[model samples]
Target: MEPYKYCDNRSHHEDSPSTKVEPTDCPKPVIIGLYGLPGSGKTARLAELKAELSNDEFAFYDGSAVIAAVTPGGLKALQNLTEEVKNNYRERAIAKIKQECYNTGKTAIVAGHFMFWPEDDENGWSVCTPGDLDTYTHILYLDVPAELIAKYRLNDNKRSRPNVSAPHLAKWQAFEKNELRHLCRHHDILFTLLSPPLASVSKVGFLIRDFRTHSEAYNKNAAERKMLEILAAGSGNVETVIVLDADKTLAQEDSGVLFWEHIRALSGAAEDSGPLKALFSSPLGYSYIAFRQATLLYEEVAENAEFEAYCQAVALKIRMHRDIVNLLHLVRGTRHVRAVVVTCGIRSVWEKVLEKEGLSSTVKVIGGGRLDDGLVVTPSVKAELANYLRIARNLYVFAFGDSPLDLEMLKAADQAVVVTGEEKTRSKSMEKKLAEEIGKNGFHPRQTVLPAFATPRMDTTRLPLVRLTDQNFLASVFARYKNLYVLHATDRPAAKLLMTPMRDASISGSALRKVHARAGFYLATELCTQIIGVEAYPVPHVQGHQADGYRLLHEEATLIVPLMRGGEPMAFGVNDAFPLAMFHHAKVPCDLQHEHLEDTATIILVDSVVNTGKSILQFVQHIRSLNATICIVVVAGVIHSQTISTSRIARALGRFDGLSFVALRLSDNQFTGRGTTDTGNRLFNSVHMA
Candidate 1:
């Protein structure tokens, strides 16, 4: 392992300019410096890379050849010149390569040396110039075995080389590797140490492609697109989304810490061999380049299968905070709510943890581990995802996170919760920043301490304490954020239009039934269309030309299942609004068979009133059991307010996939009447007999 340079300045959030030391514009032309000891086959590997990569996309060069070409008397006279003059030539060589790459808009791969340590010298002096540090976007070092390097030098006949012992060469290689790595991090250049057998030409080719395409904007856009896909895949009724950070926020244990410990144990490395701690402490900090370097560190330590195994082992060892786990369970069962774990840590590991908890289906994950996972989830990406969910997807977002790395994301959310773990394991570094955010910035976040005894961040006054276990808080969240459409207390003309006849005490029998049925038509056309969304299709215009027309999405595939008796009138109204839809009378859950759901894309369940929500829950659960993904919307004339927060229907909304509710009004009166007051009795004019 290379020794990392500890720097005082560390920026946890790349989006915050005040935290950065001196950030550079990313997506600069990639110039990769292929480096190794004198006899470590860099030239041979460069030639192989040249053949493997496309000439149009990449430009290859020999460092010494470029230096000689730019020099007056080539290598012969340059060797006799002073060290300063030789350094100037080296600078010119890199500058020329950078310029060529800039002009061509192609990546440049060049075989270069960091420093040369002769056997007679006590210590090696670095040959790296300022120009070299500024020009090279990435440095891939060939850490070939010292013995192999010595053997290769002995076998070579093209040029005479100085003889050196394996031990001396090994020391030289280590020194150069450590120094170059430190310099690269300070200069914001990506550095990866590659070993033989695994560091083949194909591996180098993949790295080049990743470097070429991984611009900051590209990464943010890719993350947004991925988040959009997740949202699009969800039930059409999702109104609220909770964005969570995995490491300390979801669990007290940090997966990144556990991952490094696992790597150390597996490799039998020293106790201080926590590469992540050192990497983040370096000048690169938490910038994109820093995370990219961290990815390379993992790649260096383990192969694909071994890396995956390590991640799984670490995931199994992680114990989620009981509070967070309970919160997720509630979120899973709540209607119109979805949770997504957006982690800067390993996505594979968090995914495994969620799967182990059996919350994987309900909670989605957007993260990265290996290079192939698409894009790295940085602080900016996390904030952007939160913003996207709120603005583009029109969702109420609640974000939970722990560190300064999460501040930007918290700011982007509508409601932010700062999770505080145990003193020893928590992010102590976040305290100052959290204070600044609450005091200086206009950001307000509630603090939740795990274990119920762990000291809260600051105090209840500065960072108000919130208990995830609080029933009132959860209920309030459900009531306010739920994808609910109700006409109660509304001043809208349509709400008044539908509720006037339904609320009239003098109206009863066929006259009242007509009003309830009309209310159903109003809810379906006005509210349901907005809930499920509309799709455009071709239609004939008045001029006999084809034009675009809109109707409910999957209108032909929609099935209206009305509970018999009271639900029949409203069901007919719904069917009237969607004339092309199929109507089925379902008195019980079993009435709708698998065939009914097989061709159904949307299921609209109509009822006159939802008293306890027990029947609605049963039907929704049954529909889910038959088809786990069908979109179900419950349309009713009146739903009791308490039923939405505490009833079985409310709970099932959280558990079942793709369910929503639309009601003419929400009644506070939990009145279940019989005889003359019964909805069915009044609708059918049987109240006279009662």
Candidate 2:
């Protein structure tokens, strides 16, 4: 309901060079202004920027209060008094804001409609009189068309208030237009129009904030300094800084089983038939037996070979030192890296490990904790650690982590890493079902493994350029690449295909496509590309006895389709790809016929992106009713690293011989700060024009 609920004022400051006063030796706070009409998604942008800044050292203030104060009769007085007292309230509010900035060392962002005040003329002003414009340090005008604003207003649930009038909306629009143009011409303000969407507005604000605050800190390090130089030289579009946790991430952790085993041995239960096993196997049995005395007796042999083996496993399984070092080198060597470091961990351990491997100087460390207890860690704590590091010096925070505990940190970080642990925590059947659903939804799964220490690599490889004129190229690409097709899978096809293409064009397009095309093309030639619009019918296959060269009849080819925006146009490409294949159209109440096929028929599904393979997985389960041989092929334009690293796709893929993947591109580009073009938009326009 409150789609733009998070949008608000972040801060307020004077823009006059004379009024601009450097507070302290403390890093100058970055002041970014997010300007837009009321329904232009300014708040959502602010929220995202706030989330990113939460992990950095810089402070953020949504200048909503300033707007509220400046409103007619001031926000508080308007609530209690009539319109007559409004002007008096406005003057007081402005004074208070100026005083607050002077007294507290905090920057302010004021959000509200501002109007140009001609020096020579002061005339009839209805809503509120023109005030001094020198208060803001940076002015950003969110140039959104009035038509779009009207659409947003009509659709908005919260703004549908009885008190809001057409007159008020018109006045606000007129004031904003005049003020934005004035700021652009008169002040040294940075004005950016909202071209992409209001969703990306907050990112622009964050960029301004960083430029104002930490640009210098970023220049201190050699690599970062070089990056800054490159950026200054206009060699890059947007430079990204990635920060990651270095424990169970760059290094692997020995299975916690080993640690548990060690604890069991320490408690004197070293025997294979120890009470610990009983405790795990049957908690009730161990509790009822009162076997404490027997367990203690076993403690005498706790430090034996078994216990040592467990410790060795725990230690060795922890990510290899070489791997950690290699990862550090990889991140640092990448020209885009502004800064890289392990934010928090056992400082001594990290230092020792890095030093021994000669990687100590490669990155900075902000770790402090006793090694014995492992680090007392959480996402917020990591966020705080990043905050401290950022505050100590101006810096942007990009982070990577593996557990749910790292979620908060990920939310706070400008960029994030969701590292996958090497374990199948979810049920294998569930994983299989999910993968099938994802395939049916028209997305392919692409996996990325961190290169080995010895691998010679640093800079990312470029993708092969394809000047595709067909708008349906994405759907066509999906149809050709995706490997899995299940009858009645539960996800939309087009959304899946969009993922990889949107993320990393190179990895998914090249590495993934090569492997998938090789395996999937061998499976079948008569691929069935279905454009599920409103319905579909099942084709029956004839049962026959085995014979020499018994060509499989009605071998179900893969079904690949894309989930289109506004309309299901992606289905047409799928239909075009497989002319002879059966077609189905999907709508709210899906209606389709089903006929049982050979148990071994391969089905490859395709989609654009795989944010979460839940839909695709669910769909796979639906098609299982046909009892066809089910192998999945998933083709996605872009694939989030989390899906590949943490999701069930990787584990489930091993379950079937027929399963294969062909992604046009795949990488953790979502939060990796990697640059990627919006292929969906490009492809859509191409197809629309064609």
Candidate 3:
């Protein structure tokens, strides 16, 4: 693995400069330098690399060739000169390469050597001049094993060279790699060591290509293809995809803010002191993509070493949103979930951040650095990636984001989340916009708000905030609220006590009916008082005075309908809660005539259990057909949340504006039984009623 595979990068929220970067007038072409030992085969490698990365924009040249052509006697004359004379020629060679690349608008890759030393020497003096460090945007050293280079050197038929021992070869190789790497950093140049074979040379080629490319145009089909392969090959066998937006969505502060602040502190300048303002405040006005475009430009002029330090500094200070960090970790532990961080922020920054959190291997980050830094992760583009994962990759995608920029992506996901936080900390306009969007789409996303002072170091001993934004919450909200509530679930001791005996095969007769009545009464009263709500009314007190009291609005007109034998005990429980409310037992939907529902403001449908929801749906549908405007509440001991969520019965009931589902327990188990397990059969000690 590369030495920089992991770095301790940290930045603080308190450290920041109150300014913006000024812009530059014109940009320069990026130059990359390929360096290796004399016998390390740099020339052959460069040739192979050029062929592999066949782009018109890329131009390659030999360091000596530039000097030979510019000088009088070419490479032979320079070599014959004294050491001092060679130094001057080397400096001039670099200048010519830089000018040629600048003039032709090409990214140049110049093959060069850092220093020259004899076979007997323990250390080699570096020939890398200040001009070379200043001119090259990036420097990559081909670190072929000394043994491999030694073997190849022995068979070399090209140039005459001195023979060196294995230990001496190792020492010389170490000196060059270590010195060159430090020099590149000292000059703020991007440096990478390519340990050939363990890593492909083509990896560096792709990095260069991506640096110049934009993320907005990433190939969707290709990305899915890669994802599918990863899924099939993954240890956990990923089935669900969780897409998260970075910046304020996953972390406390925007990464862009932290990055600029670090830059200003490192450069010893006020944030607004330069042309950076002009660059960012241009036509796009510091939008995510615009900021990225500026980053690439800023990186071009920035000292490679200093910029990287700032990158690491900001990453070190990063404190991920506590809940989100935990959620991501949870997703990692679950073999079925594949988490993706899709951000419009700097890609390298997030890569470092996730790496620091120890989730880099499992979690993939899809982001960009510069505007044209390859694959713009726009809101629409984010959605495209998510939808593609679901439609083509066969992964169920759940997306979480903040701000209007994430709206499209949220809508494209199979499940979505709008992460919000304290008003003073989060985007107010975005929070409001997200709410409006959810209502407009009619598929409300689970909304999560982090508690005050939330940090990256979340407490795992307690319930995770992410748990509040899942299918269970969504279902419950939808069930209880016409606009929000879905299914209400409780694990109350009272409800559970009743449930134990109801599900027991040993329980039968009045004993089962008594448990059913008790559970129904508790659920009905809780729903009316807390969820469905009861109306306030004036009552006659014992002192012969009127006082404030609560009642179901129009209790005299309210009607309770039980679905025959199984629903009768629960219906009687409803009657006890609303003693004035009329009770009607019916086996078929037609038993409760239109006249029975007339003048009633609320209708309570009571049942012992609702498995598939077909029978209760039939009961409610008949009542709706008679009185379309009456409020309806369904109370049951047990009901499967999943059944009501996906069944057509739920949809048919959804047409009514006033509908509420209240149950003692919303369970996944749907038991079909007779004799002891069956509610009606167990209640009356009757034969199987199937």
Candidate 4:
């Protein structure tokens, strides 16, 4: 079980520890709280992370040690203290950690607890300190199976333990995590769950290292110095650089616009408020020159609490362009593309936005007009910023933006792009200026028009908006994204090359279907086994506690959906391999009754052959409609490779999340299955009738 980062929206929401602090420009104190249930290996994980992060970059702390340092007599003295006294000591310990992290400028990873749950209790009470809740910015829970936790507790020689069942421990872990997630939400803490990794799982050390690296960009001088340090350490192989515009480019709405709108909404009752209202109505409000004035005035007039709340609210709502994010991810994946987000919006707000996306650690957010801002990014200065990345860093600059403000930066870039939104909802002024700039220059800078809606989860399209219903923006981007490694869109010819010999006119009846179906199942199961990997089984065994089950970690919930008739044979073979999987036979697209799909995590759609790939495409769409997060895999003995690569099926497959395909061979056959070549006819012994 690899450590999984929780999605931005949690099952629980609250406002507790984080409601008090203003979004400060001060070097954010990095305190990562390592939490878990008793016997859940919190100490072991802490030690491992500490050993891995042993450097000037990170500082390690033990909760008990902090308590001991402050309270004197440590655990011995604390034992005599009342629960209230103990909690006070815990708060003091957290304060000490905060000071150390702030002073040393090192990330602190502390081992702590959320609550103490005893056996036989239905609900455990939260013992988390207010200081702990407020100070720690990130919380990672060591999520282990209840049976394993029970086993570890029983095996422990550390202390006398109460008797508990696997179910009891499981319930306890669930309660703790639920309560902790709610607490983190209220406190504005980033909460994630990490399962104990199998031997094959990759290390989560990079997540920590990346997070540590991201926190430094808050300070401009420090961030600049670090960038220089990277250059000094890195090879001079970075030839291309991407310069990004913040507001309407990286994010959907302009941050400034969103902030002002939020303020107006907040002051709805006091709409007659003059000072803020006057700044907006005055000529200064419309110009970039007045940003500093407005912000400075805002600091004086707006309640610190209200302003900070709005910042948080706006930051959370700052919808990142998925296409752009995918582009960044593609760049990051290569590990060489130089990309920086240069914004004229509040640097802090953009920083918060980037941080929420888990990119602040790696991507630099440069801009500001606020009090603590060291470098401001505006239209006039954007070119200078591009020049620095191009000239000083000696990297080819590629600029992406959405407005006239980005004209200078775009002109300065080696390869410039104007990222536009659909005409209906996108900033028309920005789009108009971008079109004018392109016409004025007559250069080949790309204009990537994204989705019309602001909602990030909208299934509109992951690619740029194509305006026309026919063109797929995602596919178009792939065609242009030369760095992208895409499959040679036509697999049918290749599938034919491999499968033609296996399927001849002479090869008819169940023998042909069985051979093809078995081959499909073989390839499908192999892929499934590799991807979803096995987890530890606590069942009694003679050899060892672990087994190479050759099954998905989520084997029970893995659903095998077979297109009826021709698909059943291959699905049966797949079923033989993944015996724990639930089998659902579908005769048509509508036959995919999704009522039983709520608990399903993975759907394996099986067919003996895919000529046009229509059925497979339909099933994929139906499954995605039921559960957007479900992993869909298509298995076929032979798919017309050309159809998979060139058709809408290929494009559709690319858009869905976690969707995959496996085929024994790619076929070049364009013939419809009517006679001996018909897969369903052969399987049904209808070849004689043909």
Candidate 5:
């Protein structure tokens, strides 16, 4: 028979040194303490856990037995010792258990106590040692009802126990629980308070399994995979995904607060303190374990169907802010932009709210309510999702959040909106954090007040204002991501004809330069015409009749910025295509002045070759800083195949508006030309100098 798989009459002999298995590699060993008052059924739950878990995967120990084994004179001698001596013995015992767990590669479930309260004592003596705090990864406290604990103590026939009043027991349990929670949070341990006696064992079983398999890396991967699937299923050509936080972000009211109020009213609680309020108010804050505890609270309150009804009731009362509703409606019609609600609040509530607003089919929600939902959107998860969407899936992420919880996601986003509401209804706690993020951290976010009259967060200069409901603003945002064009030899055979003269080794100096110049002219006349568009003007026909002639849009106002020496030829080539366009020489991004962009309708940045696109990115960003609305075109003789997808300029193409790229051809060659082979050296006939 396998060891530790079955509970026996012996007091914790299965985990002894003689039965220790060979160490195997695993994630950090999880040592969980089953803690409670003496009569709170910790022993019973430990036994059940031992029976349920695999012997190969778990080890079980009784705190007293472990202490006895490590003590000099065993259990009787330890009992006779002073409190300080017993604490030393307790620490040694836990250290031994931890060492055994390390050697065996098994999770350890230990039945332990927080304090031993005498009925007449002013305070209970806490028995938890520093070793226990450092070694234990999780602590599951059995918060059984005080009446049940008193009854269990009275009925136990195995040993004599103290007779404590129910009210006294309740007070004692409350103090222990509060102190333990604080210690767990400080020690970086996951803690959950399982209540009502009957549910403790079952909850622990699930939690133990989760502890063994789940990790921060695992959760992040799962969320990324789920989001990828959602993105794939929803839109075929999605360029931007707007990740919106539910609760106070989308609506003026917080669903978590509202749901707790409804639950409180139903339970006839004197205060608005539901289990959730108490759970969050604890030292756990918004940690992953705290969110899990919140889920368990919801699960404990009602059956699955009843829970759905409660969420629906909360959803029915929610009215999504008009600005957000209008923006989402616009996004729904925009084929390239997809919206998803990523929330830490109840998923069902947000889903129901979207359904009521007829947006359920358009916007998806990623969150958790019950344990079975399998995914919980914590703050870290939200941040990871935003980053994954931007990096992994290569989608532009526009995030909207209203609290400190959303800070990470906002920071990860390409564009962030801090949704502010009317003064009284706004998030008061978020202000200080936001201020710190702006003042200390290099976080720059735009604030969007739902009602235009509402007080803005910080000064308008610090967190600039954006009108999400404005049609022109939305159009400009959509314009940023919708245009990315790559012309390759396979797509356009005529492009190969123009590339032949430029690639020939027989060409050098002015001959090679003119070939590139012609290629640039051909690309401008063919590709630039289609992208930058054309405007018709009156012209004299050859037959002495008035006719219409076409020129590049706002041709006279266009500024062609040729990157120093190598790009001058192509700049002149582009100039030949549009004689009315002006030319500017730029060696670096700063070479182009703000005054040059004032009347510029289009700034075409011409380059001979874009190997890494670093130079192109710098120029485009500089141009955007000067003029946000200028139509920018990047023309290159040949762009490396990888540079079209993974380069800095490729990423920036989706982040800036009115930006387009036109290249003569794409080459898979990763070579960066040097000396004679260099485009710049050959363009200037300076290869011999190398």
Candidate 6:
């Protein structure tokens, strides 16, 4: 079997030594008491030593068993006893072990918790205080910091074990400060486990090796056999793995540079020099601000000048890097690999890149976007990738990144490959150096160089202006509807006087109904009714608490004219629930904005029922902008939530929010139950229409 494939039982026996007797002239049985704070990995070190020595011709018994035997009970009794009682128990246990070692001529490994001693000194080593020097041949102190031991204890999920708590942790800390000094001086071979000096795993391995070699029946190959056992046991059942980048490996630009550029762009300035120079002058310039500014600038200049074209060209240039394309392709092509592109870059740019390369079909791309604007990716790209890997068991993830920012992704991956671009680029070189540093510190994955590729310039200038206009239109729509509310108003004299009617009186209920029905009607009718005549206004409000930071709420308004009863309740409920709502008292006359009479504004016309829809049909006729962005007519009650074939209203609403209805109650007109003839009751009377 492969080294890693061996079961625990097999590995244990394979490493166990057959020889029984202690060698002549060998070192005396070293009853080394390995003492550290609970879960300073003391037990793990002991286990490693046992496995290593089992391969050597030695008989070793961990003093834990001796302590258990000497006590009234066993391990549980010693662990359950109070500190003072535990000390007495430990002393008695040590006495018994000393006698046994003297008689058996076999080495023993003792693990204990010792108090500090200030006066005792036998050798230059006085850092660790020893309780019973007569019993121990050498005291190997694994002196990890209290804080580190606490972390290991917490992560190990063994807090339920006896004496592993805050009080016990404090006791261990105090003992290390006062007792370790005396123990170090008396022991022949004292090994100190220093914190932050050696990697925890490496330190554990080292301690195990030291113990094996110092045993009476020392063997050179003991360490190797023990290491194999540990490795096999540790990695026996791993399934899925993910590898990710820490920096510009995924993003076209570094986060710092992106931020700097964003700030500069937000300040309304063109790059007189390079983005780097602008960023140097204004440190606050960042990619977010830059992208926002660029978007605004594109909107402004796209109409007449070459500026928009230039911006698009630059974006295309940055996004069309050959190395990125090849890497993405390789990941996509790999079996059992659901490739995901995660970056701190602007979503707009990456979306275009994915579309241009025809790779959008193969990979899911996540990038940065405005939070309030609703364009930002949700649940976070890193979190999404982690979720995907978790669901797809047996995955071997390979993450590639170039900077520290990609640490989360890299850590989440099963394996990581740091991609350092050309060394000629100082930025790339810096990334490589940082990756090297991280790798040295055992945080980074394997590194690889992504060779440069031939640049491909895609032209968007020749594409139809209609497409660009549509994009702008969609952007505007999303920005406007990031927050949606069904504003309600009644022309009841008091309410109308309190709030002026937003539109002219000529815009009637019928016109509003047409707008609502646009989603269900033909495309031409939708274009003519909702989008052309509906008016939008921005409402601002304040949000958040007093002590913390507050938010500036910018909400867009759409006039929702609901039919009485059912429609009115839903509209009012939605509007009343959300702040920053502006309900138009009545529909108003307005000139159509677009030549194509599409309903660009989102419209939801609500009603209680459509037994005949004679009222609804007439109402839809007055709508001018039929191509509205969203024309949804909602109701609190529907005869059929899924029966679109018979209900035109359901069919219409389905085109926008899909074929689904949010209703408080839904029932067919017919009654078949025992009390079917109670039609005179007011409550049940409305069931026919409903």
Per-model C-alpha lDDT, please?
0.80, 0.40, 0.66, 0.63, 0.79, 0.40
Candidate closer to the true structure by TM-score (higher is better), 2 or 3: 3
Query: Largest TM-score belongs to which candidate?
Result: 5
Instruction: Write one digit per residue (lDDT tens) for candidate 3, span 1-690.
Output: 122211112122332111111124435456788887777888897887788776688888888788787666998787797655555566667777777666676788889878766775544565676567667877777777888788778888997777766666777778777666555545546556666321365656775675444232444443455445556656755556778898888776777677777666767886563434444445544343443444544444344455556667778887777666766676665676677888867667887888898888877777655423334455666777887876666555668887777888887775576676555666656755654554343344555666544431122211123344454432322232123144454667666676788778687778877777776676667675464567888899999999989866677888888887888987887778778888887776656776787788888888887887767655664555455568888888778876567444454355445777888788877676555467788778885554
Which rank order by TM-score, best down to worst? 5, 1, 3, 4, 2, 6
Per-model root-mean-square deviation over C-alphas: 18.4, 25.9, 21.3, 30.3, 8.3, 27.2
**TM-score for all models, in order of appearance:** 0.67, 0.25, 0.40, 0.35, 0.73, 0.24
TM for candidate 3 is: 0.40
Q: Show model 5 residue runs off by greater than 4 Å.
A: 1-26, 197-204, 232-239, 264-290, 293-306, 330-337, 423-447, 455-466, 469-553, 559-600, 605-631, 635-641, 645-690
What TM-score, to 2 decimals, does candidate 6 have?
Answer: 0.24
Superposed model 6: Cα runs more than 4 Å off: 1-311, 319-324, 330-335, 371-395, 424-444, 452-690
Number of colliding residue pairs in each model = 6, 86, 44, 15, 0, 69
Candidate 4 to truth, TM: 0.35
**Model 2 quality (TM-score):** 0.25
lDDT of 5: 0.79
Best by lDDT: 1
Candidate 3 regions with alpha-carbon error over 4 angstroms: 1-233, 273-281, 285-292, 301-307, 370-374, 452-690
Q: Which regions of candidate 2 deviate over 4 angstroms?
A: 1-242, 250-321, 337-339, 346-352, 368-378, 381-399, 411-559, 564-577, 580-690
Q: In model 1, which runs have C-alpha deviations exceeding 4 angstroms? A: 1-27, 196-198, 439-442, 480-690
Better of 5 and 6 by lDDT: 5
